[model samples]
Target: MSMTPPPGWYRDPSYPLVERWWDGTAWTDHRRQPEAPQLPLTQPESPGGGGSGRAKAVALSVAGVVLVASIVTGAVLLRRDDGSGDAAATTTETTTETTTATTAVSPSASDTPSPSASTSAPSPDDPSVVVDELNGITLPLLDGWVRPQYVAEHDIVMTTPGTYDCPGDPGLCRHGRVISRTVTANDEKSPKALAQQDIEDAANSSYDRDLIDNRPFKGITSHQEVKSGQVAVAGRAGYFVRWKVKTRVGPGGYVESLAFPSSVGSESLVIVRFAFDAGSDGPPLTDMDRITKGIRPVGDADTGGGVGSSIGPSK
Candidate 1:
């Protein structure tokens, strides 16, 4: 007759490192690391020394044999429970192992990443786009244009790469340039009035004198209105004024001031200034219209339009 062990935790037959719970006759899902087995302390030898020691030794040996027998009986019972042959036994073992692995905590899952952590806004320095965070707008970069490395008072500026000696000054100058900024100083609210007021200053700055008091275009001898009208810019109603200015030296240039209500913060008025050389080397006059149309809300998709040929660095 086989002896059945009482319900308790015992060292697992297959997994030596862990203990599994046995419920009188069968193993349970509960498992834990095996606790160290404790040995009873030996009593001090009495006057009958060797005999007492020998009896104690025999008792311990018998107890150890009983433990081994109980484990062997449990193993046999487990196999009989399966009823099938070696294949069923193997499947049982595999399932137990898989359950153990599934319950274990994985190191990687401890630190979960946030969904928004991987997202980021478009860079303002991107070669093909110019982001103006202040006024919440973006200007498309044309083939012959680039974001200026140094921007003075403008919120955003783009210009032809490289520069040439000014006709009337010792300073360097670009043939094509565009700048955008909010109109904070002026109290003018009407787009038409703002555009009309800014055009003369735009021409004077482009053809009269630069920041350093250098006259790149010598001086504006005269200027004639080439285009003036209400226009739509970046989905906003706006107005623009273009002028053909004659300079004291070189083939002069065209200047334009476009004023529009910004789509962002406070809906502030914004002014975009444009200056382009009049000769064949300058950016196309049509590019002015293209750029104005290309302006969009900061996050809008880019609308492609610009000069196809890149302007090389001045020799």
Candidate 2:
């Protein structure tokens, strides 16, 4: 029986130090340095059997040999503790060669996409307003912000200049600036678990820093009454995080994310994020708050307002 990990990037169990893509079915050629930008899946055509089966076979074979070699090397070291140093050295060399040969056939982590490879310059066809069809919400034109027509190799949309243009780190770019697809939760999952998974996915790709350094604010809710200048997510209660990441431009790289359950205890999730350069004159937290607060399901309205409606902002 095959036990594949759920769809996401995880530390390659076989490779140990590197991360590999698990497209919910099998490992893919896509890999990266831990906490780096996640590369898109590049699956090659197989001769007859399935690609996943072949990958698993190769990985298992390599793992078995490596394990056996490690045991043998350990035993040799124990027995040679009081013996000649020359014998110990020879045994070590042989074991090292065996391990190297076993791993040489696998894909190199360097083949992963670069940060530059994952970004693109804005183009024409960008509309005056940004609409998220999935969530039935729309964003009117904000000054100095352009809707990206093409964000190469990433699922995230860049709503602002600093959102995905990390000269220092490229793999963390997000291009699908308007909306994200709905993430349906399984029966066993909770809303918080779903939110944490979203964060983990980001951390897995281009988020290699400590959570403490990110300075994430905890216990966020999606209440419309929270405050005037904070994120007001629609639907159910949600999770919020503010990341103060360092980039080449300055230490002003900021990422604010809002995630909420589509409804009370429902298995559906709705998440929104805002990335910007906060060096000195970065976008205010109120703006970030307004952006999220303005999101609402189509035809969904609050007592006083709705998304892109009469209450949030005057257009």
Candidate 3:
């Protein structure tokens, strides 16, 4: 802020006089000082030309002090941010002084975290659970079971595996799985259709007795529609029914009747019927009581009955 003008000219003090210029550092363009009227060491020119006595020196002194103070303040600010602070930090908007002052901390590789652990599935105690709506009960079914085959849709037929010629009369079997098994006629589709088809499928395929409708396949024994209702899977709607009962297969005997309502629901009233052919291995009474155990329907129906269809005969 000092305003010392470059040596140029100074107002001369003589009457009607003008100015004197300077060279390098000495007064130049000098007029000889009147030896008689000596030039005062320095003259305060009257209002017309000379400058002030002490004012100029004071101004220059103040400017020098201000410049020195600025330099010192800048240095301290920089040092404080650099690493002089307990927890020094710096950001983009920070003053340049602060940036020059601090440094970011970095950790060794060992200090970094290891990879995260992988997740696992539930154990037996945890019990993998799946909810299914059967009857009015929304319950869980066993998680894993070996299912030979299953389809969103299919037909059921019943027949006992019985053979005409064999050491043990290797029983014939109901051909439960087949296109011919596709549910057709309402008469052809009830639980009876299942029973009949089983016997037929078994006889036709294995026993060489195709379409043996001689004796109506032992009628499917239905207890009472234990529970029946409309159900849907992915929007496919059908009626579901469950029941248990006993029925006679041939002229001599009867077998246990379990309500095997696998097709609880379908497009129509799903009538689940389980019946064993009287002639099956066990005693007549035991045959009828077998329903207590799982009926084990092979095809559409358990072939223990004497039904037969193109699918196969029930075993």
Candidate 4:
């Protein structure tokens, strides 16, 4: 006969990075990062006591085995005296108790999400809000904006629904877009320096060309600074740089790069990029300020109070 493993967390067969929980009968949705294995510590024997210690250990092992066997035999005899059906019921009850105790005492019990939490967890695709869990921030879903169905790796994006043909390429493009992601591959931590440096790239990507060198706005010919200054975002001091770029085809667009320390998770630097079509069809310029003001820490309710402010050009 086969025996089922007790309810516990075990290495996930599909995902090596995390462990999955088995609830006696089946795997649960619960998973967590694997913890480092701990090595057992051994107590060293005193000088000139190795032989005596070994002898005592052997004796103790033998005694433990004998004690266990005696207990097993007594249990079997008692069960035999009880009806077989009663014995089976008792075994089932004992197994259930063991499973509960094991789960309650698990080292990862504190880390596991409760059933309520699992059900109530926020989604990135929330219609009225974009939850960027990776950066621990939330952006408001203003009118005409929706979460992107597919975002680039490491990016959380919200864009205007529907698309229009690119001026220079056969690909489609949106009138407005915003992307949030943690800053990486750079050592600079100053918000102003990072924002200023990233704005050019942001403008280039939004107006000049895409990853495949597709010039969505037919390539930016020149850009004029619209705003570059210190700002407060999600209650954190940050910086932003915005520019209006002239393109060879279609109406040129406005782009901005904002940098700040994330409100959560080691306070890593985060960058938010914005691109909007530069015409009556695009989102209003004031909406940029409204969206910036609407940003808040994850789980924070929209108090409707403007928390972000542009303090003018950085010295």
| Top TM-score model | 4
RMSD of each: 33.9, 17.2, 46.3, 23.9
- The number of clashing residue pairs in each candidate reads 0, 9, 46, 0
The estimated TM-scores of all candidates read: 0.55, 0.40, 0.19, 0.57
Arrange candidates by TM-score, descending. 4, 1, 2, 3
All models: lDDT? 0.57, 0.36, 0.23, 0.56
Clashing pairs in 4: none
Report the Cα lDDT for residue 279, model 3.
40
Candidates ranked, most accurate by lDDT first: 1, 4, 2, 3
Q: Which stretches of candidate 3 lie above 4 Å from their native place?
A: 1-210, 214-222, 249-315
Number of clashes found in candidate 2 = 9
Residue 32, model 2: Cα distance from true site in angstroms: 13
- Evaluated at residue 296, the lDDT of candidate 2 is 50
Error of 4 at 279 (Å): 0.7
Candidate 1: C-alpha lDDT: 0.57
lDDT of 3 by residue, 174-220 (tens): 21111112122333334333433233222222212111111222322
Pairs of colliding residues, candidate 2: 36-206, 115-170, 156-174, 156-175, 156-176, 157-175, 157-176, 157-177, 230-289
Error of 3 at 287 (Å): 21
Deviation in Å, model 1, residue 7 alpha carbon: 85
What is the C-alpha local distance difference test score of candidate 3? 0.23
Let me know the TM-score candidate 2 reaches against the reference structure.
0.40
